[model samples]
Target chain A: MASEVKFEKVDFYYGAFKAIDSLQLTILARKVSAFIGPSGCGKSTVLRMVNRTNELVAERTRLEGRVLIADENIYDGVDLFSLRKKVGMVFQRPNPFPKTVYENIAWAPRIHGVKRTDELDEIVEKSLKRAALWDQVKNKLKSSALSLSGGQQQRLCIARSIAVNPEVLLMDEPTSALDPRATARIEDLVEELKADYTIVIVTHSMQQAARISDSTAFFLSEGAGRPGRLIEFGETERVFTNPSSRLTEKYITGRFG
Target chain B: MTRARVFDLSAKAVAWAVAISTMVFLILIIGYVVIRGVPSIASVGLEFFTTAPRGIKMQGGVYPMIVSSIYLTVLSLVIAFPIGLGAAIYLAEYAGRGRFVELIRFSADLLSGVPSIVFGLFGLAFFVYFLKMGYSVLAGALTVFLMVLPTLVRTSEQAIKAVPRSYREASLALGASKWQTIRRVVLPSAAPGILTGVILAMGRAFGETAAVLFTAGSVPQTPASPLDGGRTLTVHLFYLATQGQIEDSFRVAAVLLFVVLGFNLTAGWMMARFRRRFG
Candidate 1:
């Protein structure tokens, strides 16, 4: 079910203020790719483009290139529901709905036309198990999703996205707000999930990118108000050890953002 | 004491006095009304509520007026709730920051600020005269609906806007369509706040007199249909007080106070239940 996501020389603007400049990158199917950069580096923007979620935040946005998933141009004539169904997202914060844990997982499937109670139950259980939240919340499915701890809530969010049986998962700093143990658990979950789903993660921590990702794409905005550009993209091990660009090496070695 | 300390103490005394005076004024008004009305209510017994007015509306119950008030409130709500909620959702979620939306919002604000008497005049000219609905419950309800719509729309818009943006993002990313996200997540979260606005509008509709007076006639008979002319409790209260039936008017006032209080309490209880379920 996994699908590769490709950004072909994309230029994005938030109402005339350029955000991403001439960015070209391909995220392989069934692999974990990490985007590591500073706060305003547009890594999150690039990730959002894969599912067209950036349109929700800024109304006057303008895009200058194609975002393709599984060889289909998502920006041209694709249905947002189908596009988002194929490529799910987990936000930086754990944003579970103000509903029961069971409802949170069942919601997407229900919207997607899965109505039978037994089928919804099976999907909910399988999703929670996959997200590693089944054990703790198995007896409390009826409880509000907001009652869970932060990490648990994030995992529930992951469960909710996967319940729709998506192919690609876009995670925007999914673990930035989590504690070390919760972050490690998510890292472990990501490692396991990569066997089936294509995952793109944006992270601020260099160590986190080094720890779990198969490939690394480093992004940087050279100066203030300048559009962010992709500086380097390669195998994680090679990029960290022997980068081609001096700027990439400097950023990897903690010289500057 | 230091000068600063003295200043602080004086400020505290003044603030406390102002707060206490406000509380005292509220209690005094309620207490005086209840005391004045209770004797009249007690003398009338249950018949005061069950029987229609008779003998020039001096001896019989205010039953028809009570029924008319309820009918007006319910009909106005039925007519206005959907339109107001739809407008609110559009203004908050779909509409862009354009001139049309701005004009709509400004018109709503301006309408809400207009006096109820003005609304009564409009109702008389439009629904009563032009529409030819006559001085009936339908005309009164249409007037009340227009008067209440602006307030309802503004409050519901604020409530919908206040829902956390993250919830919308989460729903959209999970493959739900925009309408689906709004129905399942956004509206539910905003339900309690919207209910507050509804209840406030209900109270206003129930207690309204000036607007209903011109639209709904001062007929004492029970309205058999929305097209039948009737008088609400507030309009009936006005008729009684103006025509030297002071005791009957007091009884009507007491009933109005209690019914409005009942609506508020019920709404508060429902809001608490909704919060507990959602949170």
Candidate 2:
């Protein structure tokens, strides 16, 4: 089943440099929400916050406020291992494990206590098919995933995420490293996957946001040294066509980042 | 030629000269050891590895010393590997840019820089006398354990750190626990580096004379227990050479050098094979 993620007045900092400040956003259940911003605008930081990935940052960094999934505050006494299982993430680059294609998808299931070989095989096949990668990798499931093409590897990463049966899939510019052909394939896959999982993606590509996302949140840097802030959030079609803020307009029309 | 071309050619010449000189120095050292040690090898034949050391004027083999050296090296590695590797994992995976990490790193560096003789003195005082263990294999093993710990920690940390962050992120994104990510992805990639550190530590332990001399004592016999006295090949060689038994000293030196060389070569081959398997 799908789950809702809510971020309330969340602020992140690396020492004195605040990364995200007083941010509030509610991601709809089973919908694709795209966060579009220029580089270093804290888009990726926000994406990582949902899964508590920022905990991996050194202790010198600080996080405030609450990130909730399914009405539970994830940052409070929550087991990070279980939280990560429910809310999966994908990076900007295609980083499949240095394992076989089948093993890559089966790793999480195995670690989470799925020991039956037939059951794991079924999960791997189904997840790969869901990611639209099963056909291409079916014959070479035993080969190293690093041997896959960039697009194939990204899909493989997606399949790996889905095999864990995560309710929320957070992708940080997942298609930014892919070619147009691969990007289109991922775009199509995202649309199909939104029916079963809540998807949040951070992207620099406005066209990609317009093409695939259900809702769009535009963020912009406040000043030279200041961290980025949310400028606008609404339906993708309305945000792109009739943006309420000038900065959002400028960004959509390619005037300024 | 242009000025830039002239400068480039001069830089290339200097680089080549430095590289060749380094290689030549290594070759010279190795050649000298082989040439000076060959006569003793011919005299002792295979008995050097198969017989026990006898008194100064008599002819005998250094088999007891060889066995002692192997035992000490293996025991030290067994002790050092877990502690060193655990320290490395803590530094590389858990500890971040904080005062504690800096403190750990600084202490490891300081330990590495301390002379081997100081470790010997400390081992003699603490393990041999103060602790009242006496000159025994246990004391020598403990001395070597302290001697190689910093090297293993630093090298293993470097190897673990060298693994691409992308690998960790990928594994984490796939619903793996932090420990699982480290155990499955980071450790395997870092294994070759950790292994290299272990091999280097083994080499140091095998050839160590100063530390073992004070703590283990030069008892030319097989150790019946860790508490019993023993002498490694390097210590035996030093005793023979200093005692003016030229022929016996040469023979022991040759055997020790050959053993060290064989170990180094085996480690090198294992490293190469590991790279081929994992690369």
Largest TM-score belongs to which candidate? Answer: 1
Write one digit per residue (lDDT tens) for candidate 2, span A91-208.
8899887778988899888888899999999999999999999989899998888778999999998999989899999999999899999999999999999999999999888888
lDDT (0-100) at residue B37 of candidate 2?
Answer: 76
Encode model 2's per-residue lDDT on B1-279: one tens digit a residue.
999999999999999999999999989877776677776677667876788866655467778888888888898899999999999999998897899899989999999888888999999999999999999989999999999999999999999999999999777766678899899989987887888888889989999999999888888888888888799988887877777877677666767677778777877898887665445
Q: Which numbered prediction scores highest in DockQ against the true structure? A: 1
DockQ of each: 0.79, 0.47
In CAPRI terms, model 2 is classed as acceptable
In model 1, which regions exceed 4 Å deviation? A15-17
Q: What is the TM-score of chain A alone in each candidate?
A: 0.98, 0.97
Model 1, A1-257: lDDT tens digits are: 99998999899999989999999999999999999888798999999998998998888888998888989999998999988888889999999999999999999999989999999999999999999999999999999999899999999999999999899999999999999999999999999999889999999888999999999999999787999999999999999999998988998889887
TM-score of each: 0.95, 0.88
Candidate 1 lDDT score at position A149: 95
TM-score of 1: 0.95
| Local distance difference test values of all predictions, in order | 0.93, 0.87
